[model samples]
Target: MSPLSALKISLPLAALLLPLSSTLASPPLVDPPAVPIAYSLEEFRSAVRSGGPGKDGIPAIDNPRFQSAEQADGFLDDEDIVIGIYRHGEARAYPQRILVWHEIVNDEFAGEPVSITYCPLTGTALGFERGDTELGVSGKLVNSNLVMYDRATDSEWPQILGVAIDGPLSGKGLEEFRVFWTTWGQWKARHPDTEVLTDQTGYVRNYRRDPYGSYRPLRGYYHPDSRRLFPVMTDDERYPPKSMVLGVRTADGAIAIDKDALREEEVVDVSLNGSQYTVVHDPDLDTGWVFHNPDDIEIEASNLTFNAEGVSGSGLENLEAVNAFEAMWFAWAAFYPETAVYEGGEAL
Candidate 1:
């Protein structure tokens, strides 16, 4: 694996052009992982919004929290990002003594108070937002996979991908060894007659590794709900129209394909949420627009590119690489290369 390390691990968007400060850190954990569900940022944005909470308050990151860690930018440049604040509906674990030296923070979790920035090196998690300018030359290094993002629009969602635990007990504070390794993963799926006690030396064989979520495991955003849902395309094979909501528009530059079957006052002068868009329908590369709100999918085309060439990121067709626990579904070949959808049981 050395064609420049296979093009630096096949450019996963070149890990978003690095420089949030040089990145490449990990070293902490002699015991970390113990707040299994205590949240309170409006229930972490109503549990990442499958929609359900919000009584008021909790969602801040107005600036100057971009990682100097809780505040101590003495040099080794701070940036840990990957925080949580969710209260009930489960999701509470900060144990590496607050992810060791405060990595990154925008805050809030599960009850749906979103933004969880964490990038352990290309493992990717632009899921939340709040701040930063990058690294190198002039000696700068912010790098904070200490997660927490999206304070209303920088879009963030990376939880655990790189730097699982970096260094000889980096700062020590393993809350009862991360709540006994997450109650032993909810006691091995609600106790399959329980047994795995593992000769306890602060038991660290497989770590917390997703105590719930049925089985998801771990990666960037923690993918699993069909990779975060969204990929409905067709033009006529047997049905040709399932639709959950897919739109596309761009005036003068010519590229308008809204068609959610058409209707929004018959498309007269359509304007959806402050315009400036780029929504290319990828009907079948396994799955594409399920980003209910990647800040409302925009790309005012200044060459906002994404020619998946042969395609991937796991919209699942032939498939080759997709590790955020897979989320994609682009198929587009049932027959509509230009247009065709009658479905009234055949009409020549």
Candidate 2:
């Protein structure tokens, strides 16, 4: 089927040379609401009609995006970043202004050579297979974001702002795992504590040290606050996101979370102070996101518990995915504080 896999899925140059960047004001096209999630063409041809995972071979590229500093976007480039498109049959649409300006791409579809991703720090758009090699596409970039490999669970993932790098080496790929559950619920409302990976790859993506994006916090990726995921693989096993981040108890008359399967989610900066209840930790690992705060007694229970007095329960989990909001938004006000109120759009 290689004719470039029968092409046809082009929609930007900004939407055919500028007309859909909200008519042209051009700095705010993150409408975000595709989140109800739907993919028919016979459920995306019954999720790739089993032509793959039989593991024949054809992957190659491995550049990048979404390790989350705001959900990912190192402004990568592999040119015209289309990546995968064989028409409604192998459908995969990832365009957040070309993933906020090229953070990753990988390429090919239909002949079945996928790897479409985006990461606006966590606005996620995931897909896999770009390794084992046949010049199919990892079209090879890494320093340029958008890599992600899942060679029959050999597992390798990355993307900076053409999202998808959701915690714990995410390599499930059933109909591309509903596009990684539609960018992992926008990477859990923007990395709400980023953690799913444990030790993925690419020299740990840049391996940890957070000057708050001032450079030095790239490390074995995914830990926005313990929603931790970081496995790009090569025997470099830093795994975790097969599952587990669900540990919430929240307090104040009662506020427990984590039911699973992703219950119609979309929890942006939910706050209520005057009682010092500043809560926003869907997975905000030291500001990776889901913010909002007023300051008082917000007891979101999970793991990283740190306090001085009156109120000491800040450890929420349940992402194991999302995009951050901006150069880490002052670490959600110095470590997972709050402000992520999505009306923006797209979870479908």
Candidate 3:
């Protein structure tokens, strides 16, 4: 771990320092599996608290522009964190530095409208199908996660829950797609033709600095043992508050796998709601891929390839891919208090 520096700022103050702006757009909705939540819609809404800047306080990228990977090399360092997605022959990278300023990016993936959201406080980045709507930061937070609102109905959708807790669309869930939390070099190496989001985001702050903390060497609020900026609905001490976990949720349940454990074991088999699943570690990308293995297929990992009966693929191919994303342990626990957690290839 790297030593703390003057760059660190009090999180409460950090929230107040965020740039504020509001957009008239709203996020779209779809009928995907509702995220399993132990709390009622009322409880989620009741827990919501002002996260410093008010609605649109943290502006979202509406008209996103991109540059080729080679052009991005001028600003991006190899270890810089980026949220990546590949779909319909289009691969794009959204740098964390830019997202740290704008929590949401209303973007289109191969003609399919989607919203890429990141919660700096919770250390989560997720992509959701928006259809014709655009999501904006509600400037409200529950469990220290970003709460989003759609312009269409003015409903509140917490980024992690992916469900509206208030407004006419309350209880509605949004369709989601997979977004990889990996480094700049890792994403570019895998998708050479990837387009990188440019810092040309209309609103500008110091894009080089992260107000929350640093992910490169892990310090400030991002430190595994750092204290949370706000109180969560539920708290679990089983893992460090900021520790990263690859989490998956269904309409019935939720589960999380410790990233460190997945890295060590390479492959970890687990069960969710009576269905078998497997999490495979991709060393090259330094991320995990979760697959719904209903038949309990026996999987073997040799180097970067995973082999199973009637399945053979390098990294994340030839499997029923599940939409999962990396989240901070505290945030995951807060929303899904009953989530089963696994570490070291064993349930903990």
Candidate 4:
């Protein structure tokens, strides 16, 4: 079946096309006092052409169940990947095994409503504050990233961008939280008291196997040399499509620091648009974090540690955190085509 036609099999015929086309084409000339759509029909169609199982083909875990780290030891292996979040003195780990299927987890953390999302296709894991709203999979893929929708406004939010592209809340961006993509063993080593998401989800599925492939075994779509499953808006040959990077963006522009290069350098200082920022890699956890250098602190090559509290070492204290996330090179380049790439700590 054609990509467009295949979408109809799982989505309501009207829901699959009409709303998206109308929202993208143009808002009524009359002032409805609502936020105007942020993108054009061509842009919307370019990103959201095909549809998966309508809304919630893969159900989100709303009332998530968790177990102690020690209790989760049996199912999760040491090298299994997970997204770790620590806030307000609370810590939680969302395993990739679970996220690969649900895509989104609407839950509360540290008494605040947050959405933990992962798109296996693009290798992007993000956390966002929902405020009074909740997020779910819209069954749409834009630039090979998951498209999310809010329960309150029903606006579509492409996960990587974190902004509402359609519906009443268009142009609104969700508040993001820091979520680290790391191995289960590394996370447990740092946050021993962390609560791990359990597999007792209401929906029944094969939790033992992943649809995309295994990261530990490095098989299927996740293999280093595997090609992207879907077409992206743009393709840049500067980096491999599946190459991982610590991506950061500002009003001026976006920058992607090669994760592998960061690991080699351990600490790389970057300057973008006259603002200095430091990208530090934690060798132990195999994760990277970016912090704005308001004081122009000179970071040296050393063993670094980054947490919600910020990076370690002198002169780097109290640095404001820059919103950043780990993403595949292709997805980052697709959304920010003009982005500058940081290769071996130098802009290339």
Candidate 5:
């Protein structure tokens, strides 16, 4: 059995060997983002609770391996969900099946270090620039979201907030990038050269099995109406707890666009702190793109393409896009209780 597998079968012995905290010091590797935090640093630290796995229990894939799209087809079904990333001219797909077992992947894009993070409980996948340090699962949870720690300083960061609540880097946020939550088939069709993460993730696991639930049929924990597995800072009853939403956070505040409504309307515009933002649906990827439209550009969507001020293109190619990710409604509301909700092509 592998080392991690050995630990799994011997949890009592493993728990005795692992340390609860780290005392090493290192420079911050991430730059803070301009986003709103609903709670004070202390409040966030106090809200953290053990997620049962313990530190590094659900190991992060530090040195990930990958296979080509054609090779990936041997194991993955067309409907299997994937977190797609296309950056610095490189396209890669991190399969949800693989990530469901390991929550973070320390990766490199065009030589720049980064981390692909996912919180299965909150249904969120986000990318962050990691610089020289690697992020690992802290085996903790806040608002039912994953909490990560940097190996360098052991700072605790709730995945949704992306800011450190404790340790040397407390109150600092990580620079984020957009991660497209798409299907294996959709991603392969769009980027044929993409590399899919392989199951050779150092730690042995049944990559085919998802502990929480399945996303294909949205049953069990992923069902739209299912209750959260853990307690949160706060709750909202306006929408079902597990409903999917495209969440965007900015310096002004946070906003959540209903994914189903965005699909129907194609284009929805909203104002955050007097700044206009346009959200357009990309049918090919089945995702939403949020654009900071301060100048109020008129963007029209047709089929699989978008036209913004006479510049037409596929996806958000012609327009600048902001960092946005798919998250559960309850998780978003818990982190940003005052966040504005947009549904039915209008602000609710």
Candidate 6:
């Protein structure tokens, strides 16, 4: 028999003999539900037109290995970027050096299943709860963001929106957990006891180098001037296409706070569709967070802390928290066309 045919036949036999975890290990290929047209065929084709590699082309790290902070010191550089997640007292860091190859890391933190996703193209790192389902890279890009597929229902979820735009779970959104996008130095300093994801992932990949580019001396697609690799559905020029912004979505509407603007102003209070919100930047960590400002609290930037409760100060009480993420201008604008941009003094 031909090697291809023999391998194909052997796969089923191997699956029958081995456990499901070993046989159908990859989430993308495991128990995919029947395909259903969730959006207009034309729209789906438009999304497909902004093509990427086939399924599993950029593999998802299903089973990951981790190391202690002391062990991670040998490999991680101070300037290296990492997505830090802290849940229920457990902290872990997923380095960009590794995530560039595996766009998704199916991991568990504090007994809760979480999918840590990084799209090098868009420079976005997000976390979502997998619940009873598993998520994998569909090897697709919509608006330059990674399109993930759920194993249980075969629904397509765009990383930026965290909502299923296609398939069985169309219109459904996954619950998100906050992830800190910061430098290794900052993360390690904050969480000294953190566990770091090691290069011991089952897949054979070059974990040291990033295919997109380096963030230290930014080059390749990550360069400040680098143009987008794919076309977006729409474009806006309020800020540079590559400008990084802290974007927040609420039931009323969405807003994008320019990172540079926030760095200058430190704190921005804006109203989105009559609901007030505050965006505060942390210079030490080079990170930001948004919080609901129902009382129109007068924020003191120097004393501000973007904590989970809200932007807290010495005298001010904690406010309600709002979900926000840092994303490139073009990517955020493409997904949320009506999004308002926040300049330094006032939201523009």
Candidate whose TM-score is highest: 5
Report, for every candidate in turn, its global Cα lDDT versus the true structure: 0.23, 0.28, 0.83, 0.77, 0.84, 0.76
Cα lDDT tens digits, model 4, 1-348, are 223445557557756655554443221122221212334535955578455677777688888999999998998998999998888888899999988889889888767788899989889999888766678888888888899887665788788877666887666566777898999998998888999999998778888889888887788888766798788878887777777888888654688988768878887788777778887777667777678886777777554555545468765667776777888888888888878788783786
Angstrom error of the Cα, residue 124, model 6: value is 0.7
TM-score of every model versus the real structure? 0.19, 0.22, 0.88, 0.85, 0.89, 0.86
Model 4 vs. true fold: TM: 0.85
Among all windows of ten consecutive residues in candidate 1, which has the lowest summed lDDT? 133-142
Residue 11 in candidate 3 has what lDDT? Answer: 81
lDDT of 6 at 114: 77
Model 4 residue 345 lDDT score: 38
Where does the lowest 10-residue lDDT sum fall in candidate 5? 303-312
TM-score, candidate number 5 = 0.89
Off by over 4 Å in 4: 1-42, 301-310
Candidate RMSDs in Å, in order, are 22.5, 19.6, 8.3, 6.8, 4.8, 5.4
> After best superposition, candidate 1 residue 117: deviation in angstroms?
3.2
Error of 3 at 169 (Å): 0.9
The prediction achieving the highest lDDT against the true structure is 5
Model 6 misplacement above 4 A:
1-45, 305-311, 314-318
Stretches > 4 Å off in candidate 1: 1-208, 215-270, 274-278, 283-285, 289-348
Candidate 1 per-residue C-alpha lDDT over 227-326 given as tens digits, one digit per residue, 9 for 90 to 100: 3222222222332222212222111111123333222211112223333222222222212221112233332223223332322232222222111111
Clashes per model (N, Cα, C within 3 A): 71, 102, 6, 0, 0, 0
Cα lDDT over the full model 3: 0.83
Q: Residues 84-108, candidate 5, lDDT per residue (tens digit)?
A: 9988888999999999888999999
Alpha-carbon runs more than 4 Å astray in model 3: 1-32, 303-319
